[model samples]
Target chain A: MSKDAFFALGLLAGLMIAAWGLGRKAFKSKHYDEMQLKIRATGYRIGFFTALALMAVLMLLFELDCLGIVSPAFALLAVLMVSITVFAVYCIRHEAFLSVDGQGKRYIALFALVVLCNGLASALRLIRGEALENGRLTLSFGSPLLMTVAFLVILAALLIKTVKAGKEAAE
Target chain B: MKNLKMKAARAAKDLSQEQLAAMCDVSRQTISAIEKGDYNPSVNLCVAICKALGKTLNDLFWEE
Candidate 1:
């Protein structure tokens, strides 16, 4: 297999595992309380808004690329990144990011693992003496960087929410 | 408006929020939120809570 194709296959497997873990809670909504369902609905609403905004931004950037102003591949990567960002943002927000609960800690730890994976990916590339790319595991829509970006977004939202909640608690 | 009636009923039954939540098959936060007037539960949940408290819906949920 071509390097890109092999990379894509590996990325697909990793993403599938992660997606299963993330979607497990959502798919088992029947087991959740009305309050939990309500929170999940809030996540969908926030995700809708985030996706809409990303679409608008992508449109503008795509036009710029059409004008010979930017590289071509970046536009596709941007689309993938935006999608993961929306999912990450919505899930983190609805979960009350960094909540003082076991589930919250698990999400936080997963976010940390994403960063660690990025480091490992980069380190592997260096060992192979290949040019390092920040977020392009396979290019097109098959980038593992999509997951990393999503995790980073979750981390960012959690930190911000944690600080805000702390202040609210003090008051 | 908050459901102080339901809260009072639960209290009279000597039930903690967690115990009442278990009886209603809900989280304690949901029960607490209901009492705080932050959440309006479904009819089914209301009926369940009513049964658990040994009260009529009119006694706990309805004002009149």
Candidate 2:
């Protein structure tokens, strides 16, 4: 009935969905070595912990009535989230690269875009003195218009690179 | 980079990625990713691939 409870439930649901997808992928491609499987499993665990930590910190801030206080906890959570996301992406990229043809460029380009977006968003938040807000910090630059344009540009470049690489590989 | 060369040589010998993967105890995706220069194989993996392909490590993986 409470908002916090709803948020926690939503987070759990999202995590479950992610876990299901990852499990299916790992099962369908059972040819991975033990080490590779372990690495993949570790990545998933890291992701879950990162998400859990962020939610806990946010909830605590709300409870303490210092959600708006400019503190190190907010920065720490943001950095941890970014790091975990990057690690997860790396694992996914490795898995996809092994399983799919012509995925190299797409993965790299998407990764670059993600890094760029995170870096810029973090910097902007820090500069605008909005990094320590108790509630969610949404970004105007993360608007649909700018995101769409960046996505289109990255997709086009990835497509062109994939085609060219495919041809070269053939030769 | 050198893994790509090894993969090309293995392919020239009429080996599929799955076959090479089996020899190296890795997934076919790993082999494919290595060949495409998207993933770097460990030293152990490189040695396994070279052995499976019937080439010396240097012959398969040496780069200028």
Candidate 3:
């Protein structure tokens, strides 16, 4: 695989670690309640449908971009923005933060760390005339990294929330 | 649709919903929901609440 894909794989590993941490946090929080369970079930249902529709639209857009009717840069940015927005709304509405207790704060800190590292990497690429073209900071790599981290946070929230419900049921 | 019997039994015991829930190892909301008839707990939870309140299952959970 390409270096970018490899780096994304490593980030994916971090995402899974984050999900596990959030699950552990929720399991030990003592804050999971029945209301949260109903809310999470509804949220996941909504998220599944929303994600499915978004992916279908993205697939069509990608096809158009490949055919040169749409720009790849615009499609990537649009997907990244839409994904983050949808996930943020879903997590907020479901109150994942309540179940995971302090996990929201921890996820934010981790995201900040990821952004700082990505910023430095982008700067290094810019200095070497590698990541910038046409006077535009080629966020070619930034798009995936940001989307991945946002997705990681949402996935962790979903994981912890769902697991908390399952744990309560098992108890 | 009130389970006035359970309410009266709980009052006789002078125990709050939270106390009963703790004794039953459940959330206070679960106890409240049971009392309100908003939820029908399982037989196990019914038995647990009956024991916590020092009443029989029929006294707490049976509908006349």
Best by DockQ: 1
True-structure lDDT of candidate 2? 0.59
Interface RMSD of structure candidate 2 (Å) = 3.1
lDDT of 1 by residue, B1-64 (tens): 7889998998899998879988998866678789989889999999999999999999999876
- For candidate 3 chain A, which ten residues in a row score worst on lDDT? A93-102
Residues A37-67, candidate 2: write the lDDT tens digits. Answer: 6567776777677767776776787778775
lDDT of 3 by residue, B1-64 (tens): 6678888999899988768877887665567677888767778878888888889988777778
Q: Pick the candidate with the highest TM-score.
A: 1
- Chain A superposition TM-score, candidate 1: 0.58
A53-155 in candidate 3: lDDT tens per residue?
A: 7668878866666424333453555455555556455655445333343354555456556656766665666567755444433444555445555555655
Candidate 3, residue B43: Cα displacement in angstroms equals 1.5
> Which CAPRI tier for candidate 1?
acceptable
lDDT of 1: 0.67
Residue A51 Cα positional deviation in candidate 3, in Å, after optimal superposition: 3.0
Docking class of 3: acceptable
lDDT: which is higher, 1 or 2?
A: 1
lDDT measured at residue A144 in model 2 versus the true structure, 0 to 100? 21
> What Cα-based lDDT does every candidate model obtain?
0.67, 0.59, 0.62
**lDDT against true structure, model 3:** 0.62
List the DockQ of the predictions in order: 0.47, 0.34, 0.25
Runs off by more than 4 Å, candidate 2: A1-31, A34-42, A45-49, A64-93, A96-171
